[model samples]
Target: MAKAEFDTPQLKGIPVIPHLQPGAMAHSRPFVAKAEHQEPLGFPGELVDDWKTKAIDKMGELLTKYRALPVFLDACVKCGACTDKCHYYLGTADPKNMPVARQDLLRKVYRRYFTFAGKHFPKLVGAVELSEEVIEDWYRYYHQCSECRRCSVYCPYGIDTAEITMAGREILAHIGIGQKYSNEIIGKVHKIGNNLGLPRPALEDTLEGLEEEVEEDLGVKIRYPVDEKGADVLLVTPSADFFAEPHVDGLIGYGKVFHQAGISWTLSSYASEAANFGIFIGNYENMQKVAMRIRQAALDLGVKRIVVGECGHAWRVAYSFWNTLIGPFDFLDPKYPVPQHVCEFTYDLLQKGALKLDKAANDDKVVTFHDSCNVSRGSRMGDFPGGQFVIPREIIKASCNHYVDMAAETIHENTFCCGGGGGLLTDDLTELRVKGAVPRMEALKRVIDEDGVTHMAAICAICKSQFTKVLPFFGMGMDMIISVHQLVGDALVLGAEH
Candidate 1:
């Protein structure tokens, strides 16, 4: 294989977030507010009283069932083995951070409402009656932690807090308390086929602009084709990648690699977003819709392979859940079968000696890779060809000379979340977001201050966005964050050499 040509697009301004730009020159609209209507899926104003009542009853019913799940019941041993492992508890010294305590917020109710001991003799199991105050407490504490799986690593039973968190969100969504930021984005993906809701016209315009930029910057003519028939790969990514800082640069890198490799790939204006927020809400139907867009795009394009972009949850949904949710497409080419992650794609190229890499490209940068919770721990689908999340380390180590670990407690399965996992990456929740992120930010600060690690490489858009915000709060600067693909781009010895 050969090096792919890259199309460099002129980035006009950072998307959505104006504060990301420097000085007084940058202008961004206020973050979109929460849902205004009471409709379970729409604005609160359109919600009729009866509809609201039904939605409330439905939510209560779902919460009632989830509270009685076998995993929730049989998993806890009350061993207190998972105590010291919590990131938030370690950081804030809050007793609520303990895995047992966190689950007890729901589990206590579970025992009370459903268990044999509670029904027969309430006081025996420490089971209490559920009330409005109990619901309020669940709402508060479940949202307090970032749903990072640090505790699961130490849990003897592997009772994941993230699972509990998702369950809580489902209960919330049932009750109509779902956040507009993510829920609306999911709705947008369904309505317009992309989360940012960019239509085909704007998408075509962005691609054309990228083509022209490639010609200007790299003296290469690269094509970002949409709806092209019989392409080899259909590239799926988070919509934020199109306009966000550092992420768009990864797109440029993707174009470069594919162009150099002489691969036939196209971006789809339809099903453009890789994010599947339906997973957050536990709405299997919506999850299928999101994944179906990709499969439909692939089938329609006649592509042999689908290459997922760097977004973590997108890949989590695609690689982990797509096969089960919206699959059995035996028509796809069996040789290079199924959707492949960009990391897997690039890593294979390097492994096969197809693309030349300039190891010296990242030579003096002390970089660390953040294993996103969704991609690493949350994934039940097992690893890509190379390994689970370790491929990132292999790729990073291959490209950069100085690689350092961020304390033993926060790597691989034990890694701390960027505090923005699970659809909470909105700007409106700044204070709570920052507080929940205290553990990870403090760990990063320690590594930056002690180990002299300058840059952090993360694959998820949420992680990137969250770090871009929280890193500054800890008095760090912006240049420290980069996508894993950006590092790959720097290392790739392009056909049109730098």
Candidate 2:
């Protein structure tokens, strides 16, 4: 059996600039997808013999299709503004993990084939051919990126490394090279309506179990309705919430809010998943396919509105891309945006004094918030531009008596990824995931040491799961990372007079 060797670095309570170490993580490649995983997503079963030509041709096509790709490739002057902006670079000290260097991996290939100067004098422009080593580098480094877009925030040219990373992964997939975790899950969503491959019966059973538990604990009947055609709102959430701890608690919180609001909401077993892996791999068609399920469900169920749950990247796709990908959404009730985030819905009710909350229920623990990367950077909430950051914290403050924030830099748009994002959360990439979490864990330690913050709440399922798995390695309890709605569920007073 082959084992991954990780040189875990010690946390220093601050982000340090390490001496450049090339090839430090060049060998940290994820598992390649099998025939079954590739074929269903309309990719080749294995690496084709003409992979080099196919890869370059695919890159050219992507460059022309997405204006951001070509513009980003041509715009970067290599001024080094974003060199230290990436969490992976800060954690691993690998130069390749730097956003500029990572972009160059694909940029070099683009210049070599597409540019005039590169065809004549490739060396002068730092251009390289599409060789086997470059292909391997693409697999290793591109997967290392969470496509979180944190680097773009600091780039003087506004060069989005995430665009480059997504283009690179798309080209790789076009050439029959795909990451097992993401592609496999994409297949599951296509076949079974979720990343978990959960059938409708299993989902119904889980929701029934949750209803039973809530009734037993609170003496209240909170409904977890599924496939209820006449419901007013269709709730779409990540499949993890159907079974996973903390995530399920968040679902319970959402149910409690809907119950208290006296609004009818139902979960669509046909489109049960909110986490869309399609965006991770940069496949627009597949992404649209995953998103269209929700649109179809809404039309079929005759729901007046659609509301999304706590999943972060799913919220990004829903808020930013759904209208473009599967819209005009003319069939949905025109009063609300075609789809609204659950946080927005909950926060609006809080502002209107519609639901009663008991903040003292959370008085025993001091809490902090981890802004999941996609929510912080790629998407917005409410009517404001930075509502993505404000709404979640506002809800938390309303729910919990004691609330603190992580370091100012690590909390809002500058938030680091939980290290297991972008479909790299599988066991095969465990070493990379743990090492990547160092920067986040360091920020967390500061609050724990100074403010005695006992828990960190997040809106993303991946963030909650990642922190739970990695916090124990940092001398913290796995239970410290929790769902934001878990706090709401705790503090919520069901059936209270408004």
Question: For every candidate structure, what is the RMSD over all alpha carbons to the true structure, in angstroms?
Answer: 9.5, 1.1
Which residue pairs overlap in candidate 2's backbone?
none
lDDT of 2 at 431: 75
The local distance difference test score of each candidate is 0.69, 0.90
Candidate 2's C-alpha runs over 4 A off are: none
After TM-score superposition, what is the CA distance of residue 165 in candidate 2 from its true location, in Å? 1.0
Q: For model 2, give the 10-residue run with minimal summed lDDT.
A: 1-10
lDDT of 2 by residue, 1-498 (tens): 115666567889877878888877777888999989999999998999999889988988888899998889888889998888888888778999999999999998888999987788999999999999999999999989988889999998788888888888999998999988999999999988999999999989989999999999999999999999999999999988888877888999999999999999999999999999999999999999998898888989999999999988998899889999989989888888768989999998999999889999999889999999999999999888899999999999999989999988888999999999988888777777888898899999999999999999999999888888888777899999888888998899888887
TM-score per candidate? 0.84, 0.98
Worst 10-residue lDDT window, candidate 1: 17-26
What is the C-alpha lDDT profile of model 1 across 1-498, one tens digit per residue?
A: 012221221222211111111111111111322554224344343223454344435544655565534575556878877766664454334566566777887676667665787767877776766565655555555655566667777777777776776666555555545656667778778778998989999998998887888678767786777778888888998887788877877787787778777889998988898888877656666678777888888888888888888887787788778899888768677765466788888777777777777778888688987788777776632244426566777778887788887766667777777767776676654544554556566667777777799999888888888888877766678668888877877777777342
In candidate 1, which residue ranges exceed 4 Å CA deviation?
A: 1-68, 91-93, 380-386, 496-498
Question: Global lDDT for candidate 1?
Answer: 0.69
